[model samples]
Target: MAKQAKAKLDRKGLGSLGLEKLIDILLDEAAANKALKARLQTALAGEMGPDEMARLIDKRLDAIDQSTARINKARARDMAVEFSALARNILSELGAVDPQAGAERILRFLGLRFPISARLVADSARLWKVFDDTETAAQELIQSVDAEEQVLLVPHLERLRLRDRYGEHTGFLLGLTSVLAAPGAHAWRDALMAVLADEPMKFGALDLAQRLSLRLADIDAFLSLEKRKPENRRDTLTVAALLAEAGRFDQALEWVRERPRGMRLIPVNGSLTSVGPEYGAHERRMLEAEILERLKRREDAQELRWREFSETLNPEVLKLYLSKLDDFAEFEEMDRAFAIAAEHEDIYLALDFFISWPRLDLAARLVERHNHDWEGRYYDDLAPAAEALSAKEPRAAVLLYRALVEDILRRGIGMAYPQAGRYVGELARLMPELPDGHGLSTHAAFLAELRRNHSKKYGFWSSVPGGMQG
Candidate 1:
C-alpha cells in the first residue's frame, strides 16, 4: 500500500489557524526556493512516481489557496474591532475635544472609523475638556460616558464654559449650557449660575441665571451685580427693565430710588436701573400687583411662560419653603407655607404643600399629581412619609406603591441612579408591610436575572440600603 500522508488534518497547535495555513506555509517555501522545490520534487519522484509527485504538489497548492481564503474571511469579520482598545488609548491621550465639538462626535468617529460600542461615546468626551480642545471628536468615547455610567461627566460638563472664545464653536458651549440649565439636572444651582455668568454672549445666560437664581431662592448674585459699577447704560437698563417687567415692583422701585442723581442727566428714557430710584414698601407691593395686571392684560403672555407659575418660581424658593415646612429638625414655617402652596394647582406647589402638611393620606393622593422623575431627593422625608403611610394605613401605601410601580414601568422615564435606588430599596423593604405577601424579593430576584442578561438596561445603584442617600 502507498505510504500514509505525513500531514494530519488535526492542526491543533496552530490555535485559530486551520489545516490550510500549515499547508500554505510549506508550499510557499517549496515554491519560492528553487533548491527546496527541486529537492522535494526529486525526492517525491524517486519515492513514488511521476503521477504521485504531481498529485501531491496539486494537493498542497490547493490547500494553500484555501488557507489564503480563510485568512481573508477572518479579516472581514473583525474589520470594526481591528483597533480594539488601542483606539481608546489613542483618544484618551488626545485629551478633551474642542469647545465647538461634543464627545458624541468623537464616539461617532470611533464607531464609524474603528467600530466600537455606542456606549463608549462618553469615554471619548471625558478626554475632552471644554475650555481646552483635544478630545472633541471621540463620539464613541463621550457617548459611553454620557449614558449615566460615569455620573461625573454630567457634572464636569455642567462646570465647563468658554469665558474666552466665541462664535460657532458655541456648540460645545451650548451642550454644556444645555445640560447645566436643564431643569432638575442637578442641585448645585449656584455653580451652574456661576458658569452662566461667564458666557461671552448675553444670549441664554440671563434667562438661565434668572431661573437658577429664582430656583435657588437667591437674589444675592443679582443684587450684588446690580450694585457693582454699571458697564453700560444698556446692561443696567436691561436688568432694571426685566425686574420692572417681571413686576418685582418693590425691588424695582428700590433700585430706581437708589440711582445716583448724577445719572439723572443720562435719561429716565432707559429702565429704572439706568437712573436708579428706591421703592418703598407700599409702592413695591402696589407695583408688583400692577406688573401682574399688566402682564395679564396682554393676551399673548400665555405663550411667553415656559412652565406653570409654580414651576417657574425658582426651585430654591420652593425648596426653601418646602424644607421649612418639613422643619422636622430641618427648619420652621408650617402655616404660611401650606396656605400659599395650596392656592396653586401646580405640581411643584403640591410638593411644597405636602411637605408642609406631611399627611400620608394627602401624600398618597398628591403622589399621582407629581412627576417622580424630579431629580431632587427626598430620602429623609421618605421615612416620615413611609411611616405615616404605615401608621395611617399600610394597605393604602402598599396600594399607592403598586400604582406607582405600574406607572413607573409604563412611563419608562429615566430616573437618576440615587433617586431610583432609594425608592426601589425602600419599596422593596416595605414589601412585607404591604397587604400582599408577594415579597419584593421576587421582584428583586427577577431584577437580578434581568441584569444578568442585560446589565446596561437594568442600570446600577437602583437601591441603596441602610438609609444612605448616596
Candidate 2:
C-alpha cells in the first residue's frame, strides 16, 4: 500500500471549510487577539460606507496621537505591530473605495511621526520602517487621484513636509514629480527656492531642488544649483558622472581632469587617516577611458586600460583591454599580461589575479617564490588559496598550513587550538606525498619542533589524537 499525501492548508484548502465555519474560526480567534478584533471591526465598518470607515480609522488615529506613553524597547515591538496593522487597514479598506480620502488619512498617519518618534527611548528600526513604507504608499495613493484633486492636496503635502522634523521624508516632494501638474510643480519649486534664498546654508532645500531638476531632465538647472555650493573633490566626481551619464563626453572629460582640491580624512581602523589628493584616481581614470571610447579614441582607451591593469593587477581591466584586440593578438597580449602580473609589486594582488584567471600553475609558482612574504595573520586569504592549490600543488598548501598553525600557537589563541590540531592532522596526511627537498622538514621533525616550542600548550596537544604521536 502507498502512503497518503497530506492536504495543503492554503486558501483553496481552507475554502473547503464552509463559510460559517470560517466565520466561526475568525470570531473565536478575534476574541482573544485585540489587534485582530480591531481589524475585524474596521472591516465591518467598511461595509457601511467609506465615510464610516474613514471615521473609524480617524478615531484610532486620534487615540494614537493623544497617547503620551513613553515607549521603551519592550513596547516598541508591540507598537510596530499595531501601527503596521493600522496602516494596512487605512490603505486597504479606505483606500479601495476613496483614494483621495485614503491619501489624506495616510498623510495624517505620517504626521504622527514627529511626536511618536520623540516619545521613544531607543530607536526602533521596525517602527521607523513602518512610517517609511507608509510614506511610499501615500505617494502612490496621491498619484492615483485626479489632477485637480492632487492640486488641492498640495497644501496638505506642504504640511506633511513641514512636519518632517528629522528630514526622514526629504524626497517626498521629488517623488510626486510625475503626479504634480505644471502649476503644482512650479509652485513647489518656487517655495523651495524661497526657502533657499532665505537660508543660503540650508542644504535640504538645495538637495530637493537639484533632485527635482534631475527628475525633470533639466540638466542646466541642476548645474546652476550645483555651482551655488562650495567646490570639492567628491562633488566634482558626482558632476562628472552625471555629465557622462547624459552623453556629454567632452564636458565629462574636462571635469574628470580638474585638479583635486585637498586631502580628505576618512575613518580607518577607528582612527581618522588623511588620504592623498589622488583619492578616487582609479575611478577617474576608468571614467576617462570610457569617455575616450565614446569619442572614437579607441587607442587612448586601450592604453589607459592597460596602464590601470599594469599598476593594480586588475584582471577586469586587462580582460577589457585584450577584448578589443584582434583574434590571434589576444594570446600574445595574454602572455604579456601574465608577465606584468608576475612582477607586480603587490604579491597578494598578483596571486589573486592568477587565481581569478584560473591559471593555478602560475599561482602556485608565485606562492613558492614569495614564500617568506606569506603572513599567517592573513588566513582569510591564504587559507582559501592553500585549499585551491592543495590538489596539484601540495607543497604550497603545506607552506600555508604551516604558517597558519605557527601563527595560532605563537599568538597563544587557545580558542583556535582545535583548528590548529586539524591542520596538524592534514599536514601529517600530506607529508608522505611530498617530493624530496620540498624546503619543509619531515612530518616527525616538524612535530618535534612544535613540541619544543609549544610544549607548554597542553590544550593544543590534547586536541590532537594520540597526543601528537602520529
The runs of at least 3 residues in candidate 1 whose Cα sits more than 4 Å from the true structure, single-residue gaps closed, are 1-340, 356-361, 365-400, 411-470
Q: What is the C-alpha lDDT profile of model 1 across 216-278, one tens digit per residue? A: 445555555444434432233334445786657556545533433333212232112233333
What TM-score number comes out for model 2?
Answer: 0.77
* Total backbone collisions for each predicted model: 58, 0
Q: Which ten residues in a row have the lowest lDDT in candidate 2?
A: 264-273
How many pairs in model 2 have backbone atoms within 3 A of each other, for residues 3 or more apart or on separate chains, i.e. clashes?
Answer: 0
**RMSD versus native structure for model 2:** 6.0
> Can you give the TM-score per candidate against the true fold?
0.25, 0.77
Q: With candidate 1 superimposed using the best TM-score fit, by how many Å does residue 465's alpha carbon deviate from the native? A: 14
- Pairs of residues clashing in candidate 2: none
How does each model score on lDDT? 0.40, 0.80
